[model samples]
Target: MSWFSPSRLVPSRLVPSLPPYSGPYPVGSCDVELSAADLPSPGSPPPNAPATIAFRLFYPAAGSGPSRPIRWLPSPQKAHFAAYARFLGAGSLLSTAVSLAPNVLYYTTIPARRNAPLLHPPGPAWPVLVFSHGLAGSRNAYSALLGELASHGIIVVAPEHRDGSAPMAFVRAPDGGASTSVSYQIHPHKPTAEVYAARDAQVRIRGWEIGVLYAALEKIGEGAEMRNLDPNLGVGGVEEDVLGSFVGRLDLRPGRVAWAGHSFGAATVVTVVKSAYYGGEEMGGPFIPARDAGIVRQITKSSVLALLDMWALPLTSPSAEQFFEKQLPAYEPGGAGGKAVLSVLSEAFWRWHGNLNDTKVVLAPRTAVSDDDEKVEQERRGPYIFYPEASAHLSQSDFGILFPWITGRVLKATEPERYLRLNVRAILQVLRENGTVVAGYSPLEGEEPLDGGGEGKKGGDWRILNPEGGVRGWLPVDMEVTSEDRRMSIGEETGGRNDEVRETEVLGDVKL
Candidate 1:
């Protein structure tokens, strides 16, 4: 897929377009809701009330016609547009005006067919990937990436977690009546500590929500009835449908499941997996408690996990030092090839410090773990670390790809390539290492070349390096690439704020 041309960045004439999926299969998508009567809310909600999870499912399609385009934003109604416009820092009048103008509000199209037939691959079942969005992000926020993965014969399930963390989510009543749209509210007066505590709490709740979704899959695997549940609980513009196609089509095999998340969602994956590995009490943090230990254990026991530029590591209690030295190296073999953890981070991840100002704070120094430590785990786990230099925190989602045109600022506009490469690498790594699906491409192909050069003999603009040696011999590269601190300062004037943060603050008072 070709990168967006420079001419398409004009604000008045720009129409955002997602790059085509590189996989051979066409993509099919549907929305479904899961209601677990026994699942308890992690936070202070009604205990007996059934915990509900609404998600969009993307999978490979059997037949291809003119692709069905999906709305970029979930709610295209005037009310939602006004709220989102305000959240984006538009003035009241402009927000109202933009809401009234439907053309300007709903312009982007996701290149996937809705309610298309699910394609059965050569295997007995399709590999499953559960995706969690970042704070204030919707399930469709990463539509491009998720759709790409789905096109590659992977089933991508993204839950619309309405734990008061997303920018907006359609909250369905327990009785399956009308769904109400909820928007994120900013409380600037709330103490910083209180805010952190609330975020940590939400992280745990979202993690448990993931567990509930997995349980639903298990039920489907057992041939349980899923159509009896409410199917009209639509999110954004997409309506929920019957689960008849997905009933026997899902691959719930041990080690075939992979967990992936961005930002706080990434942190949630880590928390849940860590709690399962070491008892919740031993990990001692605001969110990891004994109550969630069982759920975490069940979710992470045999699943491959991936963290995309995690934002909650600093706020968590168990240090990476403790996790790497004790749990990571001591990982016991399981269905997912001994519990592998792959983190595809961006350069700007190191500069993040919540809403505070500390550009030099290293949130994930373990990316540069010692050669000895790397060697120990290399044999057990696959390449445990990868960071792309030409990317930011939002690069993993559609927002990063479209932001350049939205704001008319061309900083790091080539990030779509970086995101595409890194995302494919992460998926391929998990699949290849777990012995689920092995394709021809190397997981490390097309990464940003670290050496000061253009394309190398390996046909990748970036270099792929191994901890034991400089570059993989198969690539035929000459230079030795070592892990370096990719963290960069935006200068004292910016006070550690990346472009994404600065842009968000400028658009609205929301603290993400």
Candidate 2:
């Protein structure tokens, strides 16, 4: 066996045909009421200007309580404007109104389809979900998924990661002149480790901020209606505490909290959960009254229920095994003195488990094989199979953030709406595990039953089935690669013109 330097697999940019580069919209702006008089007519041009890439939100009605919103945060790739336009064009069926309000987000509190009157007040507390944008992305990247989730009962928070989002600055080309711009945070000599380190730092920081903000929102509640209208408030400076409080103004339960970020945001949630737990630990058992320690112990046991990573890859893979085996000195077992918290944190995101119980896991591209897999066919290109050189960006904190862009280029396009409807189930699973509501008959009408794997099954019941088994959409796809089999690639993109050789070394039989 031989060792390879870690710097050779630097990520390179592939300029796809241009797409719409919409910025993050304010969470308050989405307003689509089909019953309202301001809707657009079919086949007619939009009566309103297009707002920042559009999305929808749905929550339970008054009696049912507030639910989470599924959020769609899109990457800001300027070239894809046309694609976005087409998306909205197709999405009109979900709404009666069409407006392109630049910089303004569109939000609506809708009830799920039960054909009931709108008299019931929503339930007391609502669960929470946050959508994270990818590198060089804005907060409104995935309108397809966001709108669909909002249509249900989820409170979705999409945060704009400051480190690598699309900037407001731009060079306007002269009339009929073309403009060119590079991706945000682009680098010549990309260090995979440095990039991962930076992303983890940024996402964790943002996640903590998000948690704080949401807590504040719970306190604000209905006060938002009053404060939201004030003319003096600035959009960016509006106290997150105030915003948090305002959203929380409605009397409700904190319910369950869940975070799902694309790309780096995914990594962000994982870090923040650990951070929240760590912080809670430091706070000394929740400040309970002298006798409440017993209750506190049980309560704090599983504060965080589940973490969902959409297309995320571990930090240093197949390679980390050897580095631990040969290069790095071993730590004295269980020695707090040797276990540096930050170092572990730096590596915290290097490897992650989407399941609450770290052992059970779900990896994407179920069909995609890694270079280390037995059927390492060079021609096959998809996540099911991994290629050492292909996933150069795995080192970055937010891996799924690039889902839209990456999914756009390499595979057949799935309607964003369809994907959202399917993905929300996984989120609900997280909520259920967190002690939230059970899957009501209404929400589970079309859901499939697991053959042998879920709560109902006894032996070897991992088989989950959808109502339509042949076309099951979002089930977990597990791969053979474990923490021990993955490796890291370091180096610049080789053969500038050659698309084939993208890495410095290929570690076979190693976990991806």
Candidate 3:
């Protein structure tokens, strides 16, 4: 824990390495796509989907041993890049022209060692975190951010959801049969009945996948038999039991395991928390733990929540809106309170006044009368919320870092790594405050410390959730703003361009 601090973080001069993690720990990662047969889905699988779950686990490595670099894209490189080309509408099914664009970039690599040994920290147990990706995203898409978190000593699991949200994924059968290509199921972002039904179906599938992952973690903790369905897990050679190395390592205590997501994935986290923690609501209650074997008790009120640029439309979809209108699970008795929840919104998302307002409802604390005293029903301090000025929704993921040239030239994303560092700083502080033993220091904007000196010049003081614009471009959201001003401020803040139409609800989660 006494090594490489934020100030001392050295960026990988090499192009393939992701932005170097600021935390003191070295990171390792592995791919795991397991059969859902024994894990069992609580509900019917999403229409035309397989009974499988997939993800990449990034964690603090045990030793500085010789390691293999994790590819930014999984194997069958050109095919995966072609899917991205198709998803971006840059190419038709047979358009080799556009497909070649990502092909040129397919060789880029993640900054983690492949299937390296998991670090055994000098603590009771290593904390664990589960992260979900957004629309058109896979487990590899967010490796930079997740690896940053893992570099701080937590085991981070990024689930690859096959509910038609991904651009394209290869789903291998439970018995290691032929893999089937599952393409993205694009739906209208409008709040129409059909769209709601489509998204509601996705949430169910995603919730079930998360539950199954927790079950896998339980077995991995006990050194039980489990199979990783990733076709490329043993591509080079089987050096060791990477899956078995996780035995008795992860901390699964109630609230100890954190949950996070971005955009549509973030909406899934909101619904999953409600579905798993507070069943019996309008949605017929508790969908994930339908049977006793789910082992989702770890998903309690105390579990930490980190949501980034959460797309609000899915939460308001026709089916589960009623269930989630209530407070988040963190507000329950023995709950972790507002500090347990952190939402790092992007400036682009902030311009979408309506969506921003919806985000507030999801993160803000609601008041209720207690019959006699009229006391507050929720914690006075709401979730920690902020936005790094000039950032886009893609800033929180590896997209900006991976495609800095295109993003900078076209999307106008500058200093993408700085945005990611800001996110990691906030998240690490959140974990440390929650009783998880991590690095003791996360320097603020105007402060000088070890690891060298002042690296972040503006807004990293996560402790004071409401810095009221004191932290320069890192603007703390004023939850009390009026809806009228909210709409007008979108133009005011972003110079009237409203550059991002989706955050404005026009494009929605569609990257294009």
Candidate 4:
């Protein structure tokens, strides 16, 4: 069943392309890295002095010519492999074994073509999404999800957090000297005051890094030359001005670009969006206010927010009380922000009652008990929330697809590709309802690509987002998780994060 012998086959051969982008357009990818000095800042750089900002751009691209596929592990494959092994808690022996197969990783490539030109959509410009990776995640961590979104005509700018969250990174110097090799920074699994402080520090750095990325997008829209750190980058349309075509093709206008992330990355999305709209130098705590650049204006109440398995602990730090106290901008006084916001959790997180309660508390107003013991309920449009059946924390990410055997056989997480498709469908539908002009794929039952040409009801994937409409095991979640339910969940499963799971995995299926 493989190009090589059974024993000789590797992870790359098992899962060649990143599940295949189920959309109308071809996806193209490029690695762009910039330091503070390289950025064309009209004003001063962001605070926290983030050394470098690096990410992969996955966008709808011109499919005419031939292109080499970008490798999944990037350049210096051995280092990336070892770093991932360590991040996953593979012992020294397993880590060395993983590093020994650098060639295996080199052969593995996602479906996207390398450096292909951006496709010219019918609209003024393509909607953009600034995606943040979670702990043990790189730019390509959520390729299956982000790349799929790009295939449907969205430009996804996925940032690699150099705040010691990834396995390893070779950050380029501002002056183009030898690259700085940064490795993963580990914090205790326990949620102690010390852990909270460390996470807050990381969150601040992550938040500021996004501010710098926003500035870079602003420059790219103006046709500015951003010196990408990768020396071996493939030329797409021409050798020079690789980023030229995006001059007027990117929708970088205020309140246009969207925010998204997974796990800790999801928390980053919430914090940054909250900071952009509500927090400033005047209002302070650990929140990195968005006065640094255009972030304050770019991210508004109307901006679409898609959080997948948001890790609540980072937002729970006592230092961030000023931030956690405020409701999501979606609930902005008389604003239609709720429909655009969505949170898709894996079954694993839904079962972790305490974290589930915390996640709900942040996204929407919770049920309050009156002195007379009656539940107080109001007519509020909370962010659409749901969980796919038989899914794990890593299900929304590339980990499930890239390592199918581990996630499937060992972990019993069935339908990795299907669940991701479900997620893509729901998010795309939410985007559609939120005013983004990306093409809608047909219903999930057919698992079709983006609808070609004619606009019809069949082209709308809105049913997937509807609570009454049936999707593949995507059940409408009860937004109001009660105090009694949290107590019961503690008895059913461990109410803590494991290795790196936002909500630590509990083995058996407990009926929700």
Question: Cα deviation of 97 in candidate 1 (Å)?
Answer: 13
Candidate 1 residue pairs in clash (backbone atoms < 3 Å):
74-236, 88-507, 89-507, 136-167, 448-462, 449-462, 449-463
In candidate 4, what are the lDDT values of residues 1-512, reduced to their tens digit? 33542235655344334667878889888887777666634233435445678889999988566665677777787778767766655343323434566556566677898877788877999999988888878897788889999988899999988777877877887776777787887776566888887788778778878877888888888888777766545544344334766778889877788899988889998988888888766556455553656787787767888988888888777776777778777666444446867899988777766667778878884333345532222214678999989888877888677655555654567888888888887888788877788875554424443344213653467557767665658888888756674443221335444323443211111111
Q: What's the residue-level lDDT of 345 in candidate 1?
A: 59
Which residue ranges in model 1 land beyond 4 Å of their true spot?
Answer: 1-14, 38-51, 64-68, 91-102, 105-107, 187-191, 228-242, 280-302, 313-339, 351-383, 406-411, 415-418, 442-512
- TM-score winner between candidates 1 and 2: 1
- Models 1 onward score TM values of 0.71, 0.45, 0.84, 0.86
Model 3 C-alpha lDDT per residue in residues 105-212, reported as the tens digit of each score: 444677787777887767867898899888878899888889888887889999888887887788888876678877888775456678777777777778777878
- Cα lDDT tens digits, model 2, 157-205, are 5554433333321222323244333234432224366654544444433
In candidate 2, which residue ranges exceed 4 Å CA deviation? Answer: 1-122, 167-183, 187-190, 193-197, 221-255, 279-410, 438-475, 479-512
Top of the candidates by lDDT: 4
Best by TM-score: 4
Clashing pairs in model 4? none
Whole-model Cα lDDT per candidate? Answer: 0.54, 0.30, 0.69, 0.72
> CA lDDT of 210 in candidate 3?
82
Determine the backbone clash count of candidate 1.
Answer: 7
